[model samples]
Target: MLVTGASRGVGRAVAAAFAARGDRVAIHHRDSAGLAASLRASLPGQGHAVVRADLADADAVAAMVDEAAAALGGLDVLVNNAGQAYPHPITEVSYREWQELWARTLAVNLTGPANVTWCAVRHMLARPPGSPPARVINVGSRGAYRGEPGQPAYGAAKAGLHAMGQSLAVALAPHGISVASVAPGYVQEDETNASYKVPRGPDHAAQSPFHRVARPEEIAAAILWLADPAAEWASGTVLDLNGASHLR
Candidate 1:
């Protein structure tokens, strides 16, 4: 399994979960050498490999996927979890800034995954019949549908990912491959705690029935379940991991 952006947050948790389940894990990190080392030390399997790649660079992205596939002998799963979020008021956002934000977000959250998925699909199709199908689980955000006021680019990128996952599911089904997206709500991470803090007030607690933000591991659990071999029938489904905060 190849887990991009596995150095920290939900990606790290997902990698750990798979490793705990006795699956070989290829951890992809951009620059977090310390975090990568920590993950290597923590993972149970001897097949754990750490890969570094600047996901924004096309060549690097391709190399990352290829290297991971090689390390794992064959790619069985891909978890696209690398993403960026930049919040700017519409009036204050400049064209250049918007372009940079959109490009970066789209590259990592959309195009990068699409590229990896295409490569994995080709590998799956070439495999012998009756083999377990490969799985692609995209880590999306609730903002894809909820419309974050200050982060339109992030929302748009995630929405594109959802569409891409659904399309790929249809395109790869005949080849016995599965593609799905996991859209998580406000995940309770250190960064979110520092920057996008939801006040611990009565009104805030009442905003959702769950009364708290999602833990990183909770989201990882959803990804794990979706990536399970038995979940082949659930392909193309955008499983919402939100706490029913914005139920429509």
Candidate 2:
């Protein structure tokens, strides 16, 4: 299994969880090579390794796919958790900023994962029998449905991610490759900690009726389950891990 952005937060937790389950993991990070190395060292298994790649770079991403698959003996599951967001809300930011934000956000959050998926699917198809099953579980955000008024590009990218999964699920069904996504609400992480620590915390919690944001481990657990063979029926489905924050 390959977990992108595994140096911290949800990605980190996902790698650990998969490793705990005896799955060999490849942890990926763009510039967090040190952290990625530490994570690989800390994982429970022996086959785990660290990979570096700028998701936005097509060549690097392709190399990552090839290298990770080779290290793990073959690719079975891919967790597309690497992402970045610029908080340049349209109404407040200059037009130039908006363009930059959109381009950056879409490239990393949407296109990067799509490119990885394309390469991973081909790799999986060429793997020997008895290798891990082909699974692509994307980490999206509830912002796609609830709307990220402060970061519209983030919302749009996540929405596009879910759509991509749905379409690919059908297209890849015959190949025994399953695709799905998880749209989680405010996760407890550095990116969201400020929001939850502010006076607005209560409001954010109220949205979920859980009185709190989700923990990284919780989201990771969901991804692990979805990546398991038992979840094949969940292909084409966007599982909402939002705690009912914004029901569709």
The TM-score leader among the candidates is: 2
lDDT of 2 by residue, 90-206 (tens): 789998888988999999999999998998888889878776668999999888988989889999999999999999999999988899999988777655234423333577777
C-alpha RMSD for every candidate: 2.5, 2.4
For model 1, the superposed segments whose C-alpha errors exceed 4 Å read 128-130, 190-206
lDDT of 1 by residue, 24-124 (tens): 99898888877888887889979888988887788887787788877887787889898877776577888888788778777877787787777666665
Report residue 30 deviation for candidate 2 (angstroms).
0.8
**C-alpha lDDT of all candidate models, in order:** 0.82, 0.88
Question: What are the clashing pairs of model 1?
Answer: none
**Candidate closest to the true structure, highest lDDT:** 2
lDDT of 2 at 217: 92
User: With candidate 2 superimposed using the best TM-score fit, by how many Å does residue 235's alpha carbon deviate from the native?
Assistant: 0.6
User: What's the lDDT of the predicted structure labeled candidate 1?
Assistant: 0.82
Error of 1 at 111 (Å): 1.4
